[model samples]
Target: MNLDPALRAILVCPQCRGDLTDDEAAGGESGLVCPACRLRYAVSDDGIPDMLVDDAQPLG
Candidate 1:
């Protein structure tokens, strides 16, 4: 699913409340990565972002 640029622009990390950037290789899946927190927020096939902090995976 293609994420809208505008929506991505407004998205922030739930943990650090920092900026999120597209990370296709995140945890071997598509996701948004928070540089500050080093976490990966999953983006579902339908284009829904899982912004929950607890569900985020650690970035390599």
Candidate 2:
């Protein structure tokens, strides 16, 4: 999870436009979590965030 802090600050859930948190310690594969929606947006190996709601998984 090498995401830049500046970029992370501006990211929000595509579903609800909610704040996201780094889920490196979260269950399942690491991702950025939107607690309000219980969705986890996957982060690629190169540190790119997949913000697509269609591909987001349920937060564990």
Candidate 3:
């Protein structure tokens, strides 16, 4: 799902409260990534981002 530019600009990491960036290298599995906490947040097929902390995937 493609994320909205406006939403992406304001969306922060649920764990570290740091800025997030879209990582195209995630092979479409990870939509947003928090560099500070090394977490990847997934996006639904409906274009909604799952920003929940518990649902975040750890970055390798």
lDDT of 3 at 13: 90
lDDT (10s digit) by residue, model 2, range 1-60: 877778888999998998888887545455899999998888976778999999988855
Better of 1 and 3 by TM-score: 1
Residues 1-60, candidate 3: write the lDDT tens digits. Answer: 477778877889988888888865545564788998998888876668999989888888
If scored against the real structure, what TM-score would every candidate get?
A: 0.82, 0.83, 0.80
Better of 2 and 3 by TM-score: 2
Clashes of each: 0, 0, 0
Task: Compare the candidates by lDDT and give the number of the best one.
Answer: 2
Candidates' RMSD to native: 2.0, 2.1, 1.8
Give candidate 3's whole-model lDDT: 0.80
Off by over 4 Å in 3: 25-27
What is the Cα-based TM-score of model 1? 0.82
Off by over 4 Å in 2: 25-28
